[model samples]
Structures are given as structure tokens and as C-alpha cells.
Target: MKKYFNWANIRLVLIVLLLAFLYAFTTKRNENRKLCNTTVEFQDGEQLFITHEMVNKLLIENKRDVSSIRKVALDLNNLENTINQHEMVEKAEVFVSIDGHLKAVVKQKTPVARIFEGSGSYYVDYKGTRMPLSAIHTARVPLVSGGVDNKNKEDLYELFRMIHDDEFLKKNIIGIQVLPSGSLIMKNRNFNYDINFGKTINMEKKFKNYKAFFQKAVQDSSIYNYRIINLKFTQQVVCTK
Candidate 1:
């Protein structure tokens, strides 16, 4: 008894007991608070379920129907239940403000690029994530040809994905020329010029160089006068001079 009750041992025991009590108390309080919470936030255009109207309805339904704050909180928690049913939802959170407003923010799947398959295209984003295409007509997007063969479809989609993400380049990417050998070329609309990218190697550096070269050509007005711009060379770019 005396050994266990030594000053140092006693202090350590008290600290451990306090930590355990704090953990349990905090956990229980949080669980209880979350169990009966209603106010939440949804990020704009991110949530898959529970539209702004449903959220408002929940608030109004409980505001007039429930007198207890606990009941209001639980009603808000129910909002999360509806959002979680969507397979694309990453996570959801609800924010209740002191001024009596609810906000629910949710994370959703982001598709990088889509492939033409079965009249129902398949999309894949930067995270290598795959999803279906939107039920709408798309234009100006490079038509992926030759299909996703055993060669390398991922690279093809990712290449197109990068071009799509860059607004500056996307506008200039008139079309993609995917070869049977997995090579690529970018067409520019500025002067109906064909760019022979060749093998998709050193993409960023090559693309930047391509842009800079085109800019200089546009400045000079002689490069754009050409029918094609070839950047496949190791040291220099070739164009129809």
C-alpha cells in the first residue's frame, strides 16, 4: 500500500485516472451531442442527396414541431443519413450556427476524363478514379479513337485529362490524335496547325515549349502560317517554314 501510494507513484496514478475520466467524459458528451444535432452545412454543388429544400423543410418541420433543442439536433443528424446512401459521397458534415441556420457540406467523387465506350462513356479523374459520363452532349472534347486497347488506356485518359484541366490549353486543344502505337498529337485551332507531340514523353516541358513556340510564331505570324508543328525532335522543333 505504501509503495503504491509513494508521492511520485501517486501523482502518476492521479494523472492516468484523470486522463481516463477526461477521455470517457469527452467521448460520451460528444456522442450525445452528435446524436441529437440538426444544424449542418452542405458544400455548394458537392452534396449528392438532401437538396436545399429538404434541408429547409427539416429545419422548419422541427422548428415548429419540436420544442426541445435535443430533438432539433437529432433531426439535423438525420440529414446525414440521407446523404450517406449515395455511393459517390465521400463524407458529409453538418454545421449549425448560433443564429439558427443549418449547413451541410459533402465530398463527392471527381472524374478526371471519360472514355467513349458502349454509348455510355466511362470517366476517370486524376486520382485514378473511374465513373460514368454525364447524360449530356459534350463538344470540343478530343474524340478518343482506337478505343482503350490492352496497350495503355490509362495514359490516354490521363493525357486528355490534363489537357481538359488546363483552361488555357483546353481551349487550344482542338483534338487529340492517339496513334495505334499509344503516341499522341495535339491540334491547335489558332491556325488549323497540327502538332506532332510524338510518344507523349516529357509532357509538361514539351507542352510548355510547344505553347511558347506557338506564341513566338503567332508573334512573328510566320509559324501560324504553317500547316504543321512537329515537336518530336530531341533538341529542336520543326515546322513548315
Candidate 2:
């Protein structure tokens, strides 16, 4: 028994107990500490949909006084849920740090296309979800008008993705109009004429032809010579004067 309780062994036991006590004390202090500050951040540098003041208001309204004494007493889950429920927020993560700072990171819904039907206007996200127009900031995405509704939001989103990925289309194309027969018409930013896109099918081939035709027309300085450029037929571009 005396050999087991040597000086080295005693020191090792004391160090282990000290570590446990310090850990428990730190945990207790952290749990009892008051909330020092609250900070909000966006995940993808998106500042269009929400403001800092708005996020603070949401926490205060939902958490009912974030100035609560105990850090662990705050309802962080409820706060996260409340912020996530906001129309502009795609997701939110709320947590209290060890330094007693309450932090929330929010991901805003990304607008891929803006749909303008009559007087009604809204945003369509990349996930095919319709979001309300933001009064905070305007997203310079492709505007789609005519024959648009919830049923065709997915199709519009797909088209918007294609336009966004294409460097030439993203810089030039401004608006897309859906016809009654489900055909499409695209308006350019620099041209007075319109592109008669016959159907949504064979989009890759149609866009390829359109790109080639646009290059040749621009090179010839005759792009504006035609009123309407149609890319409906296979491997052919029909121009109307």
C-alpha cells in the first residue's frame, strides 16, 4: 500500500483530480455566464434578403429578451427555428459560444430567376422554390414574363441555371417570355430584336446554334439586320426580315 502511494503516483492523482475540477468549474461558469453579445452572419455573402437589424429583431421577438442571465437558459433551438421560418432565410444555425456570445449564421434563398406575371412579381430560387420579392435589394437575374406560375417554376429555374452558367447569355439576355403554346421568346439587352426559342426541348442544340449564329451575324455586322431570329429547326437558323 505504501509503495502504491509514492510521491510520483500521488502527484499524478492530484493532477488528474485538478484537471477534472477545473473542467467542471469552467463548464459551470460557462453555463451561468450572461450573454455578452449577439452577432449575425450570412453564409454566402448574400445581403439581398435580410438585414442585421432584422435578424436582431427576430431573435428578440422570438426569444423574448435575449438578455437572459444564464447562457444555457436561452432557447437557441427556438431562435434557429424562428429565423429559418423567415421567407428570405433558406437555413439558419443559432448557438451560444463558450465566451457567452450568441451567434447566428443564415443562408438566404438565392434567386435564379424573377417572374413577372401581370402585376405580380416574385423570385424563383435554384431549388425551384418561389420566394417573395425583397425590398432590401434587387437581384439582377433573368426576368421571365408570361405563362408563369408555380407549376412551371421548375422549368424556369432550369432555364435560369443554363443562362447563368453561359457567360455570353448571362451578360446579354435580359428577359424571357413564355408563349401560350409553351414556346419561349428571349429578349436581349443590346438588341431590339427577339429570339424565337421554339420549345424547351433540345435546349443544348438550340443554344449551340444560337451562339454560332450570333457570332457569325456579329462578325458580319448584320446582327440587327433581322427582326426575329428563330432557332427551332435542327441545325438551322431561320431569320425573319
Q: Where does candidate 1 have its weakest 10-residue lDDT segment? A: 64-73
Candidate 1 wrong stretches, greater than 4 Å = 1-91, 95-102, 107-111, 135-143, 149-151, 164-167
Q: Which residue pairs in model 2 clash with each other? A: none
Model 1, residue 167: distance off in Å is 4.1
| TM-scores for all predictions | 0.57, 0.86
Q: Model 1's lDDT to the true fold? A: 0.61
Per-candidate total of colliding backbone pairs: 20, 0
- lDDT to native, each model: 0.61, 0.84
Tell me how far the alpha carbon of residue 175 in candidate 2 is from the true structure, in angstroms, after superposition.
1.6
**Candidate 1 lDDT by residue in tens digits, 61-144:** 445533244423455566666664444444566556543444666665555454566656665544665554443323345555
Superposed Cα RMSD, model 2: 2.7
Span of ten consecutive residues with least summed lDDT in model 2: 60-69
